[model samples]
Target: MLTQLALGVGILAVLVVSGATGPAEVSPLDAGRVILGHLLPGAPWTSDGSLTRLQDQAVWQFRLPRTLLAGLAGAGLALAGALMQAAVRNPLAEPYVLGVSAGAGLGAVAVITLGSAAVAGLPLSGAAFLGALAATAAVALLSRHHGMLAPTRMILTGVALGSLLSALTSYLTLTTEAQNVFSVLFFLLGSVSAASMDQLAIPAVALLAVTLFALARARALNALLAGDETATALGVPVHRLRGQLVVAASLLTGAVVAVSGGIGFVGLVVPHTARILVGADHRRMLPVTVLAGAFFLMAADLLARTVAAPTEIPLGIVTAVVGAPCFLWLIRRGRAARAGMLR
Candidate 1:
């Protein structure tokens, strides 16, 4: 309970800080007042001349939406990573590592380059979702050995397919007009600078639905971790559960990628961080993973915009810079721990 309280407070604090940050120099107190004023009709801040229109616009219109979207994207990607890791029984599996994001990227890029009519009239988000499912299906089929999905095979196949799909996406991007090139590149690398309140619905809904599903099936996920045969013997429907997890993860990856572009590492890093903080039990770990992911991305997005003021770095670049070092440290720590256990 204390831990939950701390996490909740931490998330709120990050949100307020992020909302207050940016080119405009809005103080944290004014930002909070603006947010509260919007939520509460009778708040004195709404009518108070102390709060300027510029401050309100900066906090309510721009920063808040971007911050909230970052949080949603982080939570969604982290949850998806958790699902993929469980499904594949591999620690390295994630939306980006597993080619799911690549697939979604291809779909979205195609729509951008070729237009919606060329891609069956599906909107950007819909196209990305389909592309993710297609990529997932391809990986699953290719990774099967003697009618069973092999963990090593899945990882290798996902990497290969992801590279191939990325190449195709690049080809399409290169062929597009010069004006579209920047949009394509930014989308591929990831950003949330243009975020709006309207853009928040899809990811928010997807994350909520997937989180609920994961929590409900936490027991089955726990059993599956023991191995397929063990899970099967214990009455967990391994095949069905794997399918559900894949679809759930794909949906989440597609949803967030559609909005925030292909921001990597959150899915890969956050779940592991959660497991380290709490034990490997899904029930406890899932909530922590979601909260941690939200905090991680919000912080990353804040750094991305502010690190080089007046010129924003892409969100993906920031995540990679921060996440790579942390990931390497995790690897070394894991190796050292294993060596100690061997003694």
Candidate 2:
């Protein structure tokens, strides 16, 4: 039901965007052919002749995987944000806000800049996963006193670590080759251009599995919102659940970042949008956020591909441009809520 709609909207949005601004487009009929070729792998839908390998590669290799990557990336980031917010009981606990993405970026950047053996030989996947894991470890360590994550301490630690990582990434950019800098900068800008099937499976399956688990046990999450003591009273295994969610979501985010760079704000915006559609209940909110996040990124990725014509924008830039205003609006709304200016 919700799943099908999400899939339909995601696919349709990409198809429309591909037709409008894909790097070498054809006629309306050919657009249909492009989509059909994707749906059927090797369908004969060309106008004058058979679809060329160039065309096939253009549509299949570059565009389609990129689109799929965007949706999964968006969904994974959003879910991570949601879970983090619950785990820490904070509004500003996103991957970027808490420095997980930065940690991952710094780790991968270190490999790219210094660990040439791995960067030149192995795929970025392993580097990225290690980086994210490293960052998560730093956050957990800094926040834990005896054996628990302190919310304020965790956020401060994350911010500090994130700033440090960003500085290193910038320093590397300054010292490295121009082309290498551009490649590194793309990760900072956040993009979906590097997608491939070999890379896509991990995040997609992890996100799908986590989302299902989250949905099925949303009550536990919701109970956490009622405060830790209340959740415990209600039979929610607070520490174990938190551990499960954080590790699961972090792995998912790391997988996405390994491929998609550093897309921002989908996590922040999508959950807010979900709250509008279905109240603030995590059970309902989780699924809605997942679906909404995918849709938002698909639309944003379309803009990334088409809005500037030949000069494709990074998906992160579009999300920031659009999400900044939404962030401001949310901040203002929060002020209004505090002032008793709105219900």
Candidate 3:
């Protein structure tokens, strides 16, 4: 409980730091004042003329939403990743690895290049969500063996399908006007810079609802970890539980990917980090994963913006640099542990 509280505090600290340390460099104190001024009625620190309008705009209108979006995206992705890993029973499973993000990317790319009018008047995000669901369904179908989902096949299928979707996205980009290519690339790489209060709504609500649902089913998740037969024996309804997890994970991934454009690694790494901190118990791990994920992404976004100064790095690149090494270490650690057990 103390650790969870500490993580929550750390996430808030990171959010503040992210909001403050951007290009314009609003001080954390001023950032707090600006936020509190708006959020807390009759608060003493109400954006008095001590800060210029431009500074206020930078902090409140831009950085705050971006930072909040980063947290929400990270938390949602992390929760989705945790659920995916548990459902597939693979430590490495994640939204991107499973083609959900790539599928979402393809939908967003099509909308951007071919125009929304081409997609029967559906909104871009809605198209992206449908694409994500379709990709997940395809992977599930391909990976199922004898009435159960096979982790290895699921991972392989996702990789193959993700590659195919990427190719389609590339083809769409190449055929579009040259001016449209950069935005396409940016979306593919992912960024939260253009985040807005409006964009924050759906993801925030989705995260809350999904987190609550997952928590309610925490015991079922724990049972599944022991294998399908064991889970079935425990009355966990393995197939139904897995299906529900897939749908929940897909919805969460689609909502974030639609807005944030496929930021990777949080879902893959954060859950593992949570397990390391709190052990493998879902009840304990899930909450920690959510907090750790929010903290990780906020910190990543902070580095993404400030590391390059005026030129912001892509969110995906930053996450990859951090996640790749951690993933490799995890693999090595697993190998070493197995060897020790054999010895």
Candidate 4:
């Protein structure tokens, strides 16, 4: 409870900071006033109008969307990661584990390299969504055994498929014009700076739907922690639940990846952090994970923008730098704990 409250407050604070922050750099108080002014419309929140037209545009148009998108992307990916971890009963499971990122990358690269005409003039995001769904379907088909979803098989299959998709994406990248390589690579690395209000709709809807569904089925996810046989014994419908979770996770991943590209580590690491802070109970941990992921990504995006100023770093690079060390630490900690238990 305390943890949730703390996480919630942290998320709000980071969002406020993120909204105010950028190359221009608005103070937190001024940012809040800008937000209130917009919300209230003709209110006295900014009586002096010291924010200026450019500042107001920066806050409302560019910074706000980017911040909100970062929050949504983080929350969606984290929830999806938590779902995958629970469904597969594996600590390392993530949206990327199911080949979604690789597949989406392939789709995005196709549009970038081959031109939109190749895919019925589909936008990058649409193509990427299709690619994500395709990868998920392949993983599902390969992982199923005698009408049951096997966690071990799914993980192995996802890895193999993800590798293949990644290879194909690389091939496309190599074949494209040399000049366009940078743009393709940048998208591959991920950034929310390109965010627009229009891009927010789909991801926002998907996140809300998935969060609600996951909350409602929190017990089933918890049952998964106890293993397939135990979950089945509890009338948890293990196979069906696993299927639903996979699809939901895939949908959330596709929507976010469509707009934000392949921002990493939030899905892979945030859930574990949540578990550590709030324990393994999905009902308790899920919400915390969502909030933590949102806060982490918003802060990360802020850093990506301000760290290099006008140059801007890839969001994925920032996450990987942070996540890689955390992952190693997790491995070391897990092994130490297991050894302690044996002793």
Q: Among all windows of ten consecutive residues in candidate 2, which has the lowest summed lDDT?
A: 334-343
Q: Write the per-residue lDDT of candidate 1 for residues 214-310, one digit (tens) a residue.
A: 9999999999888899999999989878878988998889889988999988998888877766667899989998988888888899999888988
* Candidate of highest TM-score: 4
Superposed by TM-score, candidate 2 places the C-alpha of residue 307 at a distance from the truth, in angstroms, of 1.7
Model 2: CA > 4 A from native: 1-11, 37-55, 118-122, 327-343
Clashing pairs in 3: none
* Leading candidate by lDDT: 1
Which order, best to worst by TM-score? 4, 1, 3, 2
Q: Estimate each model's TM-score.
A: 0.92, 0.87, 0.91, 0.94
Q: How many backbone clashes does candidate 2 have?
A: 0
Residue range 62-151, candidate 3, lDDT tens digits: 988988999999999999999998888887789989999999999988888999877677777887887898898999898888987777
All models, RMSD in angstroms: 2.5, 3.5, 2.8, 2.4
TM-score of 1: 0.92
Query: Clashes in model 2: which pairs?
Result: none
- Model 4 lDDT per residue over 26-60, tens place: 88887777878888988775667678777777888
Residue 227, candidate 4: alpha-carbon lDDT: 83
Instruction: Write the residue-wise lDDT of candidate 2 on 124-224 in tens digits.
Output: 66777777888888888887766876777878898998898889778977887666777777787788877776778988888988888788778888898
- What lDDT score is found at residue 170 in candidate 1? 94
Better of 2 and 4 by TM-score: 4
Question: lDDT for every model?
Answer: 0.88, 0.75, 0.86, 0.86
- How far residue 8's Cα lies from its native spot in candidate 2, in Å, is 4.5
